[model samples]
Target: MINYLYQEQNWKTQLSDLITDPKELLQQLELSTDQLLSGAILASEQFKLRVPRAFVAKMNVGDALDPLLLQVLPHHLELEDHPEFVTDPLGEKEANQLPGVLHKYQSRFLLTLTGACAVHCRYCFRRHFPYQENLPKNNDWDNIRDYIEQNPQINEIILSGGDPLTLTNAKLELWIKRLESVPQVKFLRIHTRVPIVTPSRIDDEFITLLKNCRLQCIVVVHSNHAKELDPYTIDQLKNLTKHQITVLNQAVFLKGVNDCAEILADLSYRLFEANVMPYYLHVLDKVKGAQHFDLDSAQINQIYTELLAKLPGYLVPKLVREIAGEKNKTPLYGETF
Candidate 1:
C-alpha cells in the first residue's frame, strides 16, 4: 500500500516532486552509496534518474537487487559502447514523417504529445530520442490531421510520448477531440506508464474523458514486476475497467528485473486481478544505453518456455521483438498450446 500522505496529494504535485538525485534514492532505500553511487551518477548524466516517491516506496529497503529498483537504477554498464546498440535502434528517425507523428505501420499512426514522463525506466528504448525536435506543437495539429486524413488506411491513432498521461486532461482532450474529428479513426490507443508509476494520474476527469470518447479507447500500461502493482495502483486500474475501458499491459523482459518465469506468471495474475489483460512481453530493444538489460536468445527462449507451462494461454503475453523497419512486431517464441 502507498503511504496515506502520498495518496492525499494531487497527482501533479507527486509528478513534480520526483526523486531525481541518485544519492537520495540510495539513501532513501538505506543502501550504501560507496559501491553504487558513482556508477549511478555517471550513467544518469546521459539519461537522468526520474522515479516517483510512491514508486520508490514499493521497493524493498536495504536490498540493492530489488526488481523494481533495478528497473530504474542507473548502472555503469550503460556507458559501455556496443556495436549493435545504436541510438536509433527502431529507425524511428526515418519513420518520423512530421513533427510529433511517427507513421510506422499501415493502419496505426503514432502521436507524441509530450516528452514528459513520471518514471524513467533504465531500459527505455527512447532514452536518446530527440524529443524536443519531434514534439508536436498546437499549431502543428492541422498538419498531423491532414496527414491522417490523407492516409486513408489509418484506422487507429496511438497516443505515446514520454507518456501521454503526463499531460493535463485539457491538453489530452484537445488532441483527442482532433482525433475524433477524423471519421476514419476508430480506435484511440494510449501507451503510458503513468497509471503504474503514478496511479493518481488516473483521476475522475481523465476517466470521464476516456469513457465518453467517441473512439474505442485502449490504455496499455507498462509494468515489469508484479510488486509495482500495489493495492492503490490496482484500484486505479480497476476504475478504468469498471467504466468499460479496455486495459492492457506490456512488459519488457529485462535481465535482472523480471527474468524468472514465476515472476512473469505472478505479473500476469496480478494484471488479471485488476481486470487488465497481458498483451506483449517485449524483448529488450538494442538501444545504446540499454544493452545491459538484453538477454541472449537462449535465455529468453528458456524463460518463456517455462512461462508458457506456468500460465493459462490467455494470461501468457506474446513474446516479441520490435525490429527496425519491420511491418509488425516479430514473435520470438515458438508455437505453444
Candidate 2:
C-alpha cells in the first residue's frame, strides 16, 4: 500500500531518477527514432511514466518496473496533433440546462466543477469536453445551486469535469454544503480519474468529507486495465470502501488499451478485491478522433461470454453503451438466465 505521508518527488526529479540513459526510456514503451525525434524533445520529461507519490509507494520499490506509472506518463506523441479532438465531443454544452449544470439525464444533473486533471487519458470519452466555456467558477457555483434548488425532482447530482476531485477540499466542502441545503437531492455521485491516476488525492480529509456529507455519496472511478490498479490504488480503493461510499468503476473499452478477456477479468477481480463494485464496461463512444478505439458489439459479446465463464454474476461488469439522449445506459450483450 502507498504511504500517504511520503514526500512527493517533483516530476523533473522523478524523470531524472528514471532516465539512466535517454535511449533506455524509449526502448521500454517501444518508440521509434522518428517518433522520439519529432516532438520527444518537447515533452521528454512528460514521456517518463509518472504516478502520484502515493501511487509510487504502492509498487515494489525494489522493482523499478511499474505498469500503472506508465499509463499516466505522457509518452504518446499522438497527443500533440490531437487538436481535432475539440473541447466537447458529446455536445454536453447543448445538454447543459444551466451554466454549470448539465441535465443530460432526466433525474440527474452533472456539475462541471473544474477543468483540470492530474493526468489526461488518451481514450477519455469526454476528451473534447468543453471546459473553457462551461466550467463553473467559485462564484458561478451559485448558478448550479439555484438550478438544483428550483428542480426539486433532481434526486442525484453528479460532480464531473476533467475530474471533480481536482477541486480543493475546502471548495468541495462548500459545494456539498450548498447541495445538502436542497432536501430533494438525496444522492451525490463523483466521477473521477484522480484516485486511479494520483492516489495521493485519497486521504483522511477526502474520506472524511464524503463520510460527513448529508447526501448519499457514490464514487464512480475510471480504471481501464487491471495493471492500473496497483497497491497504492488498492489502498485508496479500500479507504473509499471503509467510508461506506458506494464505490464503483466504469471502464471504456479501448483498442490498444484493455480490449481482451483476461485483462477485463483481471480488472473486475482487482476492483472487487479493492472493494469497488464493477459497474459498467462501456463500449467506446464514437467521437471523432477516438474512432481507433472503438470495439464492435460482436467482439464485446465474445469478451462478455468469456468473462461470465471466469467470474460469478456479481463480479462481472455490465457490457453497456451510453447513447446520447437516452435516459440510462443500455446493456448490450449480457445473457439472460
Candidate 3:
C-alpha cells in the first residue's frame, strides 16, 4: 500500500502534485521499466499522464494490469493511428455555441468551466478537446447569462470540463452564484471525476456552498472499477447525498478495466453502498489514442446481458452510447449495435 502521507495534504496540494512522469509512476507501483517505460514515454508525450497519488495508492502494487492503472497509464498502443478513431468523437465542436458553452441536449446547457483535471484518464474523449481556446472569460459571463435568458427552455446547467471540481471553491461558487442569478436554471449538475480520484475535493466548504444553492444540485462522478471506491471516497460521496445533493456514477466500459459483467456489478453495488445511484454505463467513445479500450459489439452484448441478469433494475446503469448529432444518448439494448 502507498503511504498515507498524502491523506494529510489538502486537495489543492494533491491536485498540484500529480505523477506526470511514466517512469516515476512505474517505480511507484514497483513495476519494472524494461518493457513498459519506452511506450509510456511516447504515448504520454502525445496526451500526457496525470494522476493523483491518492488515486494511485488504490492500485495493486507491482501489477501493471490494475484497472485503475490501465485507465491512466500511457501505453504505446495509444500512438497507433486508427482511421475509425478521430479526435472529435462526439462532434462537440458543432454543439459549442459560445466560449465554454456546449448546447447539446435541449433543456440542459453544458459549460466547460476550466480545462484542468485531477487525473487524466487515458480514454477521456475530451483529451484532444481545444480547451484553451474555448474556456470562458470573466466578461464572457454576461454573454452566457444573456444566452441562458434568451433560451427559457434551458432549466439545467451542467458544469463540466477537465473536471469542474478541480477548480477552487471560490471559483466554483462564483460560477454557481452566476447560474443561480438566472431564474431559468432550476438544476445545477456537475460532471466530475474528482470525488472518486481525489475525494478531498469535496471538502466541507464546497458542501456548504452546495447546501446554500437555491437550485437542486447533482454531481455525476466517474468511477469504472469497484476498487476506486475506497472508504474515504465512499464517505465523501455520501457527504454529498447527506446534504440533499443528488449523486450519481457514470462508468465507461473499457477493456482490461471494467469490461466484465461481474466487475461492473460490483461497481454498482459499491456505488449504491455510498448512496450514489448508478447512472450511465457508457460505451467507449471512439476517440483517437483510445482504440485499445474499445470492445466489439458481440463482446459488449454478452457482458451487458450478464450484467442485466446480475443486478436489480435500480442498480443497473443505463448502457448508452453517445452518437454525434444524435438528439439523445442512444440506449443499447440486447443486440442493438
Candidate 4:
C-alpha cells in the first residue's frame, strides 16, 4: 500500500532530506560502484543527485537495471559529446521575456515558478538550465503581472520550472489570485512531476486551494512507468479527478525505462485506472547528458501503432517532439522537417 501518511516526515522535510550524495544513494539501494560505468559519479557533479526518499522507496533493492533507478542514476554515457545534443535544445532562451517568464506560443506563456524539484532525473532536458540567473527577484512578480495586463493575446499561463508545486500553498495561491485578477487570462495550467515523486504533496489543503480557485485549472504530471503509480499516489490522483479537476500524465520515451510497447501499454492502462488521462508521450529532447535516452521517430510510430491496437484512441498520448523555434510541438506522425 506504501502510504506517505506518516506523521513524522512531511513532503518539505522529505524534500530537504533528499539523497544528494550519489554514494549514499547507491549504498541505500544496496548497489556498488562495480555495477556502474566510469564517469557515472563524475557526471553527477554537473547536476548533483536529488531523489526524494519516497521515490527511492519504489526502487527494487540490488536491482542495478531498475527502470526508475535508471532514470535518476548518473551514467558515463552522459559525458558523450553528441554534436546534435546541446544545452538549450528547445531554444527556450530565445523566448525568455523576463527573468522567469517565457512567451513561447502565440497565446500561451510559461512562468518558471521555481527552480526546485523533489527528484532530478539524469536525462532531464533542463538539467543544465541557468536557474540561478533566471529565478526572479522577490518583488519582480509584479512585473510579470503587468506584462500579462499589457498583453491581450495571452489567455493561457502555464506554471512550469523545476516544478511549480514545489512552492508553498500561500505562495501559489498568492500568484493564482494575481493571475485571476487578469481578465485576459482564462486558463491556468501547471506542469509538474510532484505527485509521482512525492505523492504526499497533494494533501487535503492543496486540493482545497484548487477547488476554491476561480480560473480553469489543469494539472499535468510526469510519470514514465506504471510502477511509479503506487496505491497512495493513485489515490491522490483519483481524488483530483473526483473533485472535477482535470489531471493528465506526460511521459518521455526513455530507451531503458519505457521504450517498450508492453510497458507503455501498461502505463496507459494504469493511468486510466488512476483517473488520469494520458497526455504527451514526449520524445527525448536533444539535451547534453540525455542523448542516451533518445529514440527516433520511426521507433515512436511503431509504439504508437501498438498502443492504438491495444487501447482506445483516447488512451494513446500524442507522441510529439519540441523543435527549436517551432510554434507547437511537432507531431511525430508527419514529417518533422
Candidate 5:
C-alpha cells in the first residue's frame, strides 16, 4: 500500500515541471523511473516520473496541489497484496481478431489507433495492454470494415487506444473517411484524454476534421476531477462545440480523486459549464494494479443516490460498471442506502 505521506513528499520533489510536447516528453519518458518499474510496480503505486515540461509549467507548482500530477504519477501500488488483479482487466486484447480492431460489444467496434498516451493515468485499465502486437496495418481497415459490414445493426464505431487522437490529423482523417464509407455507421465516438491532458491537441485543424465527418461526432473525454479543467481546457472544449461536436465526459471513480459527493457534483456542474455533458461516472474497472482505487458497489450506490438528490436530473451522470459478456453497463442503483 502507498503511504499518502510518502507519496505527497515524493511527488512534490519528482514532478517539479510539466511538459506536453510529445517528442520532448517521449525523450524524458525514455529516461523515466516508471519505465524501470513497468512490470514491477502496480498501477496504483506512486513513483516519480518526469512530467512533460509543457504540462508541468501549467501546474500551480508553488501550491504543491496539482490534480494533473495525481492522475499521471505512480503511487505505491499494492502489487503483492492485489492477487486478484490481472494483467488484462477489461478483456481488451481478447476482443481483437485483427490488429487495432476490437469488436467486443454489439453495435460498437473500437479501433486502437495508437498506444501512446500523453498522460499515464494511475487507474487506467489498459496500462498493461500489449500494444506492439496490435499495431494497425494498412489493410486492417478492410478487416474492420468487413466486421462492421457483417453487423449491419452496428451503428457506433469507437476510436480508442492509448488515445486515438494521438494519431496525426492525416492518419485520423484517413480512418474517419473509411469509417464514413460504411452506410450503417451513424455514431463516431472518440474516447480520449489527450485534449484534457494536453489541450493543445484540439487545434482548429483537428476540430475541422471532425466537423467535416458525416457521422455524428461524439468526443468522450475522461476527466476525474474538476480541477483538471481550466480556462484553456474550456477553450478547447468550446472549439469542439463550435464545430458542432457533441462533447461528453466520463469520469472514473478513484480513491484519492473525485470520490466525494461534493467533488463529483462539482465536476458535473463544471463540465456542464464548459458545454460538455457529464455522461458516466464509472465504478473503477476491476483491472489488476487498480484494485486499490475501486469503491465498493454499496459505497458507489450511496454516492450515486446522493448525487441524484443533490443535482438536477440532467446534470447527474449515471453510475455504472462494465461487465464482460453483459450486453450493457450494469447500472448500480436500488441496492444500497
Candidate 6:
C-alpha cells in the first residue's frame, strides 16, 4: 500500500494527455489495421476517442476481440441508424431543470458536475448528451444550491456526469462541503468511471476528500468486466474501503462483454473481493450509437438466473431496465427496489 501510494502521480495530468486518435490507441495495443477499419474510425468521429494509457495497457495486444478493447474501440455497427436507439434514452433531457440540476426522482436530485470524462466507453448511454447545455458554469451552483434547499424531500444528491471524480480534490471538497450545508441532504452518490480506467485518480488527497465529507459517500464505480479490475485498481479500491467509504459497481450488460452467466458470476466475485457490492447489472440503455451492445430481456433474465445459481442472493445484482417517463427503474427479475 505504501509503495502504491508513493508511486501515484496526479490523475489530471493523465487526462490531458489521453490517446484521442483511434489509430494511436490501436497502434499502442499492437492491434492490426484491419481490426480498426475506416468505418470504425468514422463511427467515433462524433463521440471521439478518450482512453487513458493506464486503461489501454489492460487490453490484450493484437486481439480485436478483447473485451476491454471492444468497449472503447468504436465499430461500424454503431452506425446502425436504429429508431429506438435515440439520444436521451433515459429522458434526462426532459428532466433538466437547471443547467446542472436534473430533477426526475422526488427523493433525489442529479447534479451534472461536468461533461469531462477520463475514458469514453463506446456503449456509454450519455454518448449523445448535450454537454454544452447541461454543464453549469459561474453562478449556476448558487441556483442549484437554492433549488436543493427548496426541495426538502430531496435527501440524496447524485453527482453524475461524464465522471464526477475527474474534478480536483480541493474543488470536490469545497463544493461537497457546501452541499453538507443542505440540512435535507444525507447521502452523496458520486457516479464515476475513474477508479476503473484511471486508478491513479484515487490518491491520498482523493481519499481524504471521501473521508472528510460530512455526507455519507457512495462511490458507484462503472466496471463492465472482472478484467477491468487490474492489481492497481484493486489496490485503489482497497484504499477506498479502508476509509470505510461505501463502494458499489454498476455494470452494463453488453452483448459481447460479460453477457454469459459465468462472466457475470466471476465479475461479482471479483467485486466482492475488493469489498465493492454488485449494485445494478443494467440492460444497455437504448442510446444512439450504442445499439450494438444491447441485449434482449430474455437473455438478460437467463444470465441473471444462472448467476443466482452460481452465487449467493446478495452477490446477484438486480436485472433492471430504465424506461423513460417511468417513475422508477422497471425490474425484469420481478424484484422491486
lDDT of 2 by residue, 40-87 (tens): 344444322323444444434323224443333344443444544444
Ranking of all predicted structures according to TM-score, beginning with the best and ending with the worst? 3, 1, 4, 6, 5, 2
Tens digits of per-residue lDDT for model 1, 109-206 = 78998888899998899988999989988899888888988999999999998899999999999999999998999999999999898888899999
TM-score of each: 0.98, 0.80, 0.98, 0.95, 0.83, 0.95
lDDT of each: 0.92, 0.69, 0.93, 0.85, 0.72, 0.85
Candidate 5 lDDT, tens digit per residue, 1-337?
1122222332223223344332343333353444434532443233224343434444444332255555565555635457657777677767887888887888887888898776667677887788878988887778788878888889998999878876778889999999999999999999998777666678667888998899999999988888777776777788899778999999998876676888899899889888999999888876765776777767777777788889999998888777666677778787641
After superposition, the stretches of candidate 2 with alpha carbons farther than 4 Å from their true spots are: 1-33, 36-89, 334-337
- In model 6, the runs with Cα more than 4 Å from the true position are 1-7, 334-337
Cα lDDT tens digits, model 4, 92-144, are 88988998898878888998878998889888888888887897776987899
Is candidate 2 or 5 superior in TM-score?
5
Q: Mind sharing the TM-score for model 2?
A: 0.80
Worst-scoring 10-residue span by lDDT in model 5: 1-10
Model 4, residue pairs in steric clash? none
Q: Give lDDT for model 5.
A: 0.72
Q: Count the backbone clashes (under 3 Å) in each candidate.
A: 0, 4, 0, 0, 19, 0
TM for candidate 1 is 0.98
Winner of 1 and 5 under TM-score = 1
Clashing pairs in 1: none
Candidate 2, residue 175: how far the Cα is off, in Å: 0.6
